[model samples]
Target: MSDVRKPWLPPRWFIRLAWSVHRGLYRFSGGRVGLWRPKPGKWGAMRLTTSGRRTGQPRSVILGYLEDGPNLVTMAMNGWGDGEPAWWLNLLAHPDASVQLAGGSHPVRARAAVDTERDRLWQRWREIDKDLDAYAALRSSPTAVVVLEPRAGQG
Candidate 1:
């Protein structure tokens, strides 16, 4: 397989379009239609709502995730594009956030997986998606694997 990454990424317009549609479906179905993992994958999906780093307003995005015991693991890949996703950047400024699943929402704190844990999570992603490396190669920098830990003392 070639290491070239350009062809692997979806166009920016497509990304925006898909996101809009997903958000609409999620809202219209009352957390049923677009709440599961993305197509062709077996993981879970959650609406990660974060406070905008600059504006301090709420920002939400649907992401595919895997549950690691009590933590939710997700990759910060913007459709394999070169730029980092806004939600990940937001977490850097303010790690506290909330995740809404099909069942309910929970308070959570986001952090980057480090060292061996990062490696393990990245490998697990590849195991789930055989073309993960090719997609990662599309990015100019390494994609971050974010872990969302449930916050304490929240009902």
Candidate 2:
């Protein structure tokens, strides 16, 4: 598994440090900064709060996301590494979760994209980041594309 070509993953220490800085910036800014894309047309970071699958505790992580009509789309790419992200795994066990955006928090239902939808959304991401597929290729397994749909009467 170590031989898996993960050209996108930075050094492990850098990953940890970057995550801390990103999370700190988001928390410190009250969802204003580090919460969305700085560029005009790109995915922004949001805090996805999920219930831990094993511990059943609230767990939150920052992730880049794209708006898709009524749904929010993200990926299970753990910084372009091999294994799936914890939030995605948690959602698999318990699909109910919450997302914190620049506006506010809302309850959402999580599901992985399928078939043609997956292809379409993947293409959408490609439009945003030309190197998306190249980063995805670094994984030994297929990176799951996750969609977060707002729950009725909840947002």
- Pull out the clashing pairs in model 2: none
**lDDT by residue (tens digit), candidate 2, 24-115:** 98779776777764245777778999999999999999988998887999989888878988899999999999998877888999999999
Listed in order, each prediction's TM-score against the native is 0.89, 0.88
Name the regions of candidate 2 deviating beyond 4 angstroms: 1-9, 37-40, 153-155
Candidate 1 residue runs with Cα over 4 Å from true position? 1-7, 37-41
- Per-model lDDT: 0.86, 0.86
lDDT of model 2, residue 144: 92
What is candidate 1's lDDT per residue for 1-155, written digit by digit as tens? 47545445567899889988999999898787887643334677899999999999999999989887788899999888889899999999999999988778899999999999999989877778877887888778999999999997552
Clashing pairs in 1: none
